[model samples]
Target: MQNDTPLYQLDPTNRFTHRTQDYDAYRPTYPSAAIDAILEDITPQTVADIGAGTGISSRLLADRNLKVWAVEPNAAMRATGSKQPNITAWEGTAEQTGLADNSMDLVTSFQAFHWFKHNDALPELQRILKPNGRLAVVWNNRDRTDEFTKRYGQVLQSVSSKPVGLGRLSDATPIRQTNPYFTNLREISIPHQQALTLEALIGLANSRSYTPQQGAAKDLLHHRLAELHRAFANNAGIAYLQYQANIFLADPA
Candidate 1:
């Protein structure tokens, strides 16, 4: 069944304002294989990670010894991300990253591209990227193939008054259509998983802005999640949220 109710309006300036702590704590990182594939042929000296919530993607790029500009609009998220070494956490959005024209050799956004207003952001991203720059958009899509994962989806959907469109990676039609500024689209998927206890799973849910985090809804969500965990947790009393790190790479046209 489709949820036709609109999700609560997001704050234009601080979409993840209240969810930063949970986001930093529970959001899974991109797979190393995905990272390796993104950096496969090119040696980039400078990279810009737009919508870099809590620096998860920025730190990954920094680990490769590249200078990274972790551009994020949310104050709380940017502050937490700034503490990481080799990262210059800038208070900026994908549409207005405060960087010189043609300043970056590569531009990346992990689990962030969908949030962007494609028309405005594409030009801004193109402005900052060098002639040879590549744009990579990535997301860790939850694998709902197994019973546990399907049940977990039910937990979130039960609490979500608005439909959560989490399957964006599988359909590249919109991303491909919106941005004529890019060409030679390439896609890759890397299998991944994250182990979580029941509490952590709740934390993961809280990290999503669309989910209800207060009132009876919050109570109901957590209760169902605990029940789900009890029914499906493995021998070690842990649940594995499987994912496929989907990456879409293209050259600036």
Candidate 2:
């Protein structure tokens, strides 16, 4: 997917270092069904969670009592994730995870795969993973078909400092096929819902690296989000943000 599309010129590793608080607080969590699909037919005892920002995906595997090495290049993000139970956080990038060769049963990247240098990362993932190991990539795309979500997306688009195509929305199948390190790619989509209060919705928008962190644009983004929340939220003042959790699972080549 990245072959046909250009990515952001800025270093991906440093993008979220400043957004760590919102990222850990407001980003949507993966569904249990998605976890079931990732671990299906194989019981992974050891996992290397690449780009494991704040150990979001790492905690899922760890909760299953699996040993997880959450590899993240951002020191701030890694430090926060290191506090979680059943996880060993490593300060490393997807292209250069400091893990041994053929040592992991599974390697996963959630909401962070788009940042990887695809060519370099694929081989490293293969090197660290066992012969039958699986590499699962995941992204949660909001249901833009919904009117509120559509308007919400519009607000983000208005203030976004970078282009949207550079990130998670891109398809991973073509990207995987071009690389020899991973093959037999399979895709799964699970419905997910996030009930967010107004502040959380704003926090979620602020968590994105592409969105403006400070300026009049940031204020405008927040104002519009609040107005939309007023118009769309339920009686409980909670907005149900719908998402389709897209998952791509592939085996080592």
Count of clashing residue pairs in every prediction: 0, 1
Q: What RMSD value applies to candidate 2?
A: 2.4
The most accurate candidate by TM-score is 2
Question: Tens-digit lDDT track for model 2 on 1-253?
Answer: 3234444345777888899999989999989999999999999999999989898889988989999999988888987743656799888888899899999999999987877777788889999999988989999888888888788888888777664454346469545566778888878999888999999999999888878878898898899899999999999999888889999999998
Which stretch of 10 consecutive residues in model 2 shows the poorest summed lDDT? 1-10
Residue by residue across 134-163, what tens digits does model 1's lDDT show? 998898888889778778887888788964
Error of model 1, residue 158, in angstroms: 0.7
What RMSD does each model have against the real structure? 2.4, 2.4
lDDT of 2 at 250: 90
- Poorly placed runs, candidate 2 (over 4 Å): 1-5, 164-168
Cα shift from native, residue 247, model 1 (Å)? 0.1
User: For candidate 1, which ten residues in a row score worst on lDDT?
Assistant: 3-12
How close to the true structure is residue 253 of candidate 2, measured as C-alpha lDDT?
84
